[model samples]
Target: MATEPAPISFARGAPSLDIIDTEGLRAAADRAFTTDPAGTFAYGTSVGYKPLRAWIAERHGVSENQVLVTNGSMQADAFLFETLVSAGDTVVVERPSYDRTLLSLKGRQADLRALELEEDGVNVRAFADLLAGGTDVRLAHLIPNFQNPAGYSLSGDKRRALVALAREYDVTIFEDDPYVELRFSGESQPTMLSLSTSGEVVYASSFSKTVCPGIRVGYLVGDEDLIAKIAKLATGTYISPNMVAQSIVNEFVRGGSFETSIATVKTALAERAARLADGLRAQIPDARFVDPEGGYFLWVEFPEGTDGDALFDAAAARGLAIVKGSDFLLDGAKNSIRIAYSGVTPDEIDEGVTRLAQAYASL
Candidate 1:
């Protein structure tokens, strides 16, 4: 008899659709149809829908002129790179950062220099030294809160220091803060934009992590002049993001459901994070992980000499798939793996961690 495999998944970063608010979509549709159906369907200005921009500014404490809504933060990054990065231009990034950021910059033929990431944040002295030595660096991108694979938040002091370094070096800082609002525990840190009054920080965030990923709504906030430049590029590229989707998000946030939805998702993610951490501790005693205060990932570092690729294969064989840390690094970090707990239920976390333990033991 052929037996079916166990159904356990931890691979994706998307939110479960079951919790998404379709009713908000209906309301948005109604408003669009009733108020200005033709306008909704027509080509929008590349600067994005005006009301959505205003909403974003209000939500993030920036002016509407500073906000340029894009298809998603991924697109936001693309636009920024396209506008700012010349071929062979040097950029600073955190090692083991988001893979997509690496791919985007590489696509532009930009030279990416990675700074070693510490648990608290990127090492300040090393970062300062790079700038102080004048390393032809054009831009520095950082995910300050609940960073992707590392799942570490930058302390307030470090955040300020990094910004100061950027100012000292006359380099632009791309503060990629997609996971800032996902905090399940701990205090929220001040954003680089909040700290910098000179418009040196270009901030990007998304609704994919908090709301439905399908909404495909994210935005960038920066100097009005820089944002206008991005808007020109956006006009040539995407024309404009889905107006209907923007309206949906606007309606959701305005109706107060967005806040409620955030609270709901946070509660579930907190439980899953706790469950996974507990299971990892019990099942793989040798595995070391920093339990994230927020966001969807638990970064587990296996003992030195453990083969991350082999462990990945073994876990996949047991119907549990996870991303090895080496995949996140530009220079290859082979002893860690990023386990995302956001997409799975609490029970699934337990099962996945148990299978991961078995795979680690076998290795």
Candidate 2:
């Protein structure tokens, strides 16, 4: 009997556990033990820990009342749809976006209007047309920084234009920004939250990427009044979020370990991204891709005639897991593939690509 090699996954947008700060987490546990363990374990504010909220508010330059803690950023995303979207309501999204978000929106019965993604971000002209077509758009959800699956960031000009368009069309922009802090290189862009004068944008981010995945602490920031609406929804749902995790994150942020952890992951991911990009170029000369500035993805286009699904299956059979790009789109991308590089090491990336190249060759 032949045993398959353990698969090297290039699927999930997972940060490497290799560099995660276990010591900082241990320190947080210690603080929790001393500072009232029972209270830490008990139900706390649905708005999240005051200190954590305060820290996030200060970091993003919003008011504390404008921030609500969530089980994770995805839960915040769910609440956003619940608060704003009704059945058959129109929601705008990037053509190839984070699949989970698309699924969530579909679950909400949202009429998803997808804009074609460009290297700089969404196709602004197409976006304008979508707006001009007179759909009663309830939300325009996006990943403006180091976008998931696509790995493209919105330009400042486009960001301003999109926000203005949202304002013109009376659409709220839901900015899912889990990857903004992971930039290994390049200057930062202005957030949609910073651009909105009318509070048309709701910003969500998680510590799962930078700090630790299991911490499960993330937040939603908007105007105090809007945040109050979200918080009300939170109370009805789970009574409140996990206070112990909140305490741990609050302790971590206060102690200044979060940024250090971020830098560590960024360094490793940057190296892996470069390695994958180079390896693909060497091993599969026809593979088309853009090397990402940050985040876990590198979007690849196979030879025109190749079937991405077949390639994925072949790769899996060869013990290398990669996502078919069509999974991220509403229509389909039969020849497109998305490879996540941050979760695995440089060596694993090399081995994964070797298998991937072999799979592509066999196909």
Candidate 3:
């Protein structure tokens, strides 16, 4: 029998499974059960495990009342969609956004607007124009830190201005920041919630990237009243988010494994990113992409006239996986691609980029 070539994947923004502390999580689960079996398995509060809630609250300088835990950040996103946005209400998002976010907004029947994303972040001038144009925008959804598929953080000035614009337009800025803690370089900027002088920001993050992905624990931080409303929705929807997972996450964080895991993951991702960048530079010099300071994705702009979909198909056909830039579009982002180094090994990144460069040249 002929051997199949291994698929070199640059398709998904997944943490490398090799470095995940599987044994640590297993031990944490055992500890949770040994300590409180009944509590571990019981139906719990919708707002999350109190200890976990307190931990997050204290870390972020917010009260436990400001936090509402969910199954994952995706669930938080859904709850916000259901609670805040009415049908036919306008929502603005980055031009090339996380595809799932666009899908979520569309599922809620939101009229979507796209703001052009620059290297520094969303075009503030354009967003200001939208606010002034009399469009009744209900939400401004953004992945401000190392935005997925774009790999750029908003400038500090723009972050403040964006919050100001949201207040002026009476729009809630939903900041999805799953990868904020993953930065390998650069100083952190103030979060949207922190910049909101007018109380118009909703913040969300998840442990899926930092911890094991199976631990479906994420939380939304916002106004206490809004969190209470969402907690009610969660209670009605699923009774509660996963108590068992929340307990396990609590143990993991309390044990101080979270920081250790983050350091390990960052080291690996940083190395992988460097290798990927070097490989691309050596093989395809014409390709352009902002070298991310930290994050899973590297946004690559291919040579002019390159067909993104065609390149996507070509790469897949050759036992490699890559995302077409068009897949991340509400409007369009042709002639580019998103390569994820977080999921693949450094060798896989090199191999994938080599194959991708070949595919590009062959076209």
Candidate 4:
């Protein structure tokens, strides 16, 4: 009997264990305990650890009053959604967005209008048209840099246009950018929050992408009034975010381990992304995808009329796991899939893409 091949997963969008800085984290934890034992152990205010909050504000060029630390970016997202959205409210999102965002908005019973996500970013023209046509849009959520499923960065022109639209339409732009620091190449565009003078952008980001995900530290930066409202809601929900983890993260940054870790992760991800792209092009001539500049996910589309479910099942059978594009959209994208290369090695990426090719052939 022949042994089965080892499973190669391109599913989880997390750093591989080999890339995680365990030793550095341990040191940070020790420093955190020694430097701020009381703050780390106590149930502090809902604003999160003060030091981390201050650091985040300073880094983002915002006042400390505009920041709210949360358990993760997801919690920050939830707070923002609850504060901004009510049933029947209209929210605009990218067609192929992060699935969890769609699920959360759907749970709120908000009317979600998904725009076609292009190579540079969301269709600003379409969005402006929607606004002009009198669709009272409450919020526009975007993944700005290295977007979650598509791995496309919003171009500079699109970014400014989006901010301008938000200002003119009086709609909020939720710039959810956790992978901003993970860019493998090119200069990053200015965040919508930075571009907006009318307080039209609410920015959310997470340390989970650059640091280890287990830390569970994320934050939101926005208008002072808006952040205060969210913070009160956060108080009712969690009393306080995890202070121990925030303190550790603070120490990690203060000690310079954070930058080192980001560099290492970026180098690894760049190699893995390149390998996955090359492998797909070589092994599966029919596979079509835009190369990502710096993020974890790569979106691939097969010929039209292909069944996504059948492709998913086939990939599983071949020990290659991927996310179907249908999960991110309200409907359609039956020929698309998202491959997460962040959690896999370059060698694993090569093998996984080959297995994916086999699965596509089987389909």
TM-score of each: 0.96, 0.97, 0.97, 0.99
- Compared with the true structure, all predictions reach lDDT values of 0.86, 0.88, 0.88, 0.92
Best by lDDT: 4
Q: Cα lDDT of model 1 overall? A: 0.86
Range of the 10 consecutive residues with the lowest summed lDDT in candidate 2: 32-41
Q: Model 1 over residues 7-72: C-alpha lDDT tens digits?
A: 577777766665566776677667766776655677788777778789889977988999998888
Candidate 3 local Cα displacement, residue 11, angstroms: 0.4
lDDT at position 63, candidate 4: 95
Cα deviation of 237 in candidate 4 (Å)?
Answer: 1.0
Error of 2 at 93 (Å): 0.8
The residue pairs in collision within model 1 are none
lDDT of 3 by residue, 298-326 (tens): 99998678888888887887788998888
Q: lDDT for model 4, on a 0 to 1 scale?
A: 0.92
Clashes counted in candidate 1 amount to 0
Give me the runs in candidate 1 sitting further than 4 Å from their true place: 35-39
Per-residue lDDT tens digits of candidate 4, residues 269-338?
8999899899999999888999889989899989999899999999898888899989988997799999
Each model's total of backbone clashes: 0, 0, 0, 0
